[model samples]
Target chain A: MSDNTGTKVKGQSCRLPRKRFYRARAHSNPLSDSHFPIPICPAEFDYSHHYPYFFPSGGEDHKNGSASPRKVRFADIGCGFGGLLVSLSRLFPDTLMLGMELRDKVTEYVKERILALRASNPGQYENISVVRTNSMKYLPNYFGKAQLSKMFFLFPDPHFKEKNHRRRVISLQLLDEYAYALELGGIIYTMTDVEELGDWMRSCLEDHPLFEAVSEEELEADPVVKLLTSATEEGQKVARNGGQTFRAIFRRIKFEEE
Target chain B: MEETAEFVSNAGEDSASVAAVTMDVDNGLIEDDKSKDAEVAPALIAVHPFEKSVAVAVGFELRLFDLEGNCSVSLVDDSGGPSHSDAIRAIKFGANGRLFASAGDDKLVKIWATNPWHCIRTVSAEKRVSAVAISHNGHYVAFADKFGLVWLIGLEGDNAKQSNNDKKAVMILGHYCSIITRLEFSPDDRFIASADRDFKIRVTVFPKQSLKGAHEIQSFCLGHTDFVSCLAFAYPSGCANGYLLSGSGDSTVRLWDFISGVLLATCEVGAKVGSLEPNGTEDAQSPISDLCASSDGSIIAVALQYSNRVALLSCDFSNGNLSVAKVVTLEENYFPTSLGSSSLSKCLWMVMGASNLPMPGSAQLPTRLRIISGLRKDPSDYHCHDPIILEDNEVPGGQKLLSELQGSLDVTKEEAALAAAAAAVKASMRNMMIKKEYTLERREMRKKNRNDRKIK
Candidate 1:
């Protein structure tokens, strides 16, 4: 149908605008900017309507006054078609998960897909929900710092231009945000068919102050890593098109006891 | 910190939200505890685990504290939220106080986590929820709304919202248009008892897993002329052996054998006791707002709507007799909304909602609800202040007034009146006039002053 998913943004990282949620068009400014600015913090973001159970965002915990009613531990960033989210839902049935997408139409598709699955399975998919927002711009508004245990960056757009490198999903500044939202031992999973983009994400996390490269043996042990090869639509498309996909996983370094 | 949650009961936490009732300590009787703070709105109190408890109130402002003095987490504070933005109609704790659930006028049912006291799951209904009941297993929460439907949601299953099919409800039972005001699962969780505003209580068999037997009505508790507001097991902590006690708007508390659907005893607590019954109103102070039975099934507490009083009765399930043991009077202008009792500590907890400051001259605004609990053996030893302590005493405990329990003296007269009305509905007013009304025909004969008086 219509690809209203990506809008051409002007100024900074890369001058030639083909498509970007990753790189800026101008080198002067590399920070991701959205025309729709979000709230300063989560208190301004009401998520009651988005949750399956009564999250009473308006109603704080009655037992202890200060505790948040709930915390979102699973997040799927740039969840294009929500394929990974839907697939990963079965793997972590008890976990409350959320998907943040940039396009309204795609987000609607994910919601409808989730709704259909829920209706078919009754009381099953409520743990997973989707919202339409640019994760790079408003991730903190949805998840509290150190609230997430696992995050997925599956098959994000590969901005090939050398000048547009800063626009990639896994970049220097965004790594700090990712590290902030994840627990000390939390894992960040990145998968892409483009080897160069995969390498970019690997080096970005490697150089981040709060992150350390996960061992290959440890990566092999994670159940979620299995889905990286065949879960998302883009991953499946890459596999069907005879393209080699790459995976890079990193762990938050501080406060990790083991 | 390792939290060692001792055996906790369902009475609830301290402090309150909307429309709270408190007992003042001056006379060792219930006194209205007014809101010293202006920001708190009104809320609802949840009846819970029959063991030792911490009263939990979710409302305009929320308050949760231990009534038994063993609050490992010490969750007492003046806070808001964890309640419906509008009003919370009912809240009940699951079996051992492991789970808590509340229904609000917002048509939302929130199942809360107890240790931390947060709403973990929110279930939406088609109508404003009237009552909430947790299953004996503490896993399923049964709720009824303004609409006549009964919904059962399993708390342990995948979130009700995620299921592909409408698997959230184990089964749904209903009455035509009457609102279901209370729901209770038998101690065995085999049968679910439901009460409606239309003066009906239906007990339906709860199938082990599926709701296939939901349509199989076990029995019906009838005979109330007004709405039945609350129900409690005759033996709350026992085997639930086919006996239940119900309180109604007709200002009567009745004991029934659920298996036979027969009325056992009807104890009158009405106009004779100053219930402030409103003329021609079907639902008002005349209705029993809340009722509970002690674990041993020896005592049942009745709180009348707007009566501002709690009547403790000695219940004999064997002969189906209910005798008023004591009438705990709340002095001052106070409104009693809910009553809870813990069998473990034999503590009777009452929640009262007061609106004004009770000053020399102050405007009446429905301010706050207070929660107080007292040891049943010695009612005077009750505490309404020092909320977190067993001295649930915020004020003086309510004074005990010894009064003879009024037997069903009004039953025959009320039955006759009900029969007359039933006939009136069947025949026209003209037909009824021609048929000779009972009081009217006698009145005419008496006015004539015939030799009938000489014969008598």
Candidate 2:
């Protein structure tokens, strides 16, 4: 196969050159056009005295040593506004799911949704969360390698204009980040409304040495994929307006660097 | 070096001296006695109160610091194989710290055995695993991912036949257009409480015998206007209130009776909370990043992210009232707060600070637990420093903070070698050429422009 750079990709799905990979940048205060201005947490929340629990330390002992292995299986990358997050929690009640988003507004929105979910279904929705974080910057922060069984990027900003492509959430550089974050056999599931953006994501995943397509049939037939089609806020919008929603699933393949 | 210092109480011009005091981090003690007199109080961040140690996730690793700063600090490596390659988002220490559970973007919820942290088992997920909360008895490990999926893993049966079996992934899904942010098992282990982005709290009662879903929708706590960031059950320390406090993007920590779904009290903090205008209208603010209550539920700590402060208030549930007791100022760079404390650990709560440390040179991203220790001292006793909530906030408050965390630095041997290799490569490509300066006059003109704007 030709390198991403060697090929002048015709569409968004084909792999682009490494140079086309997103160059991570800080978010601009995009103009918010809303009736009530979205609330944001104080920038300097005084943690001066409180300690943040980075690791498990409380009363989490398995009463039965034979109990379930303490393990996590699913992940969300750049979970914006957490629309998909709420959907996934109900779809896979037994599988642990995590939502990673960069914006505080988005994460906070998800937080309220989670608390309410837990309040209503204390038994079922207690296993989900939307963490406030820049996914591109912190994939390894929350998870261990090969730890995830699946990952998703749904309708992430395309950074459409050329100069802003570097700011796009998905790119060759981010592909490596995902590749390392995922376990062997783990899958990366992505969806985009823009065909060009879909091509961009496809190219990013396809070009990486570690990932290969899970087959079109597998992508279409997966039950979890149904949740993407039926439950997402954007999915509803796509259905209503007759907009196209393209999705691709890539599994991590074994690779030897040496 | 002193930047501009703001005061909670208007003292005299000499207040600048009080603000200038730096922490004597080496001695595990505050060097200045006079600065202690300042009224600026400390607020709680994230609280993870375990039995032996109160664990906090800062950046790449989890810091298992002492609850009272009297014991030795323990560190756990949260890096995912590569150098600084993992973010420790949610960490829960097993009973007696024998086994600990952690989850992050790596999509793996790893259960580590004690002493030398070894990954004994892992719960693999399809997406970034954001939150992991093991039951008090550790029978079920509940985890939520970015996709808003909640998974209940029953540890009772792990027959090898189940190995390599996709059948193990039993997921419960529902909740449209929102992400699940935080989840916790009720004190009895019979129920679970979860918070999501949609500003709703759901309670599910589990079956008595089996770890399977009880399918019982008990009640919904429906008052938060924005995402609820943190949720905690009333610690069963003689408190029969059965209350649940939720921190939200609305900048208020609302207390709810989990069983009845009644709004108990809303502890407001920051400009948004005080924004009750002269005309009784104010601009709304973001949700509280973190929340923690005392054992008796007398005091609740709210960590305000954009507000740049932490506030402690008295929660008078009997009358549904809240009064701000004190607010502590924090450094400007910190964001995304975490809070933790135990039943007796109420007077002092942990706050995780300066979580997202932009890598000094690169634009690469970061993790769940990037922590800094001893950023603030408990004002009641200045000599007593407590752990802040950042997961890496594991170090003891004073002298041993760095030494204790020396074991869990996210850097790996392979990554260290790669760093050395990269350094060598860069050295080989070095070009010794000095650039010309634009001249002192130009620099001064730029500085003057910035200063003029500040004056305005």
TM-scores of the candidates in the order shown = 0.43, 0.44
Clashes of each: 77, 187
Off by over 4 Å in 2: A1-258, B1-51, B54-56, B63-84, B95-97, B115-117, B157-169, B209-211, B235-241, B271-284, B330-336, B346-359, B362-397, B403-456
The residue ranges of model 1 lying beyond 4 angstroms of the native Cα positions read A1-258, B1-43, B47-61, B66-83, B157-171, B211-213, B236-240, B276-285, B354-375, B378-456
Please provide, for model 2 over B298-373, each residue's C-alpha lDDT reduced to its tens digit, 9 standing for 90 to 100: 5576665444456766666666666676665443333324555544453344343222332243232222223333
In model 2 chain A, where is the ten-residue run with the lowest total lDDT? A46-55
Worst 10 residues of 2 chain B by lDDT: B427-436
Docking class of 1: incorrect
Per TM-score, the best of the predicted structures is 2
For candidate 1, give the DockQ. Answer: 0.01
* Model 1: number of backbone collisions: 77
lDDT tens readout by residue for model 2, A1-33: 133323334643224223113222324212111
User: Which one is best on lDDT?
Assistant: 1
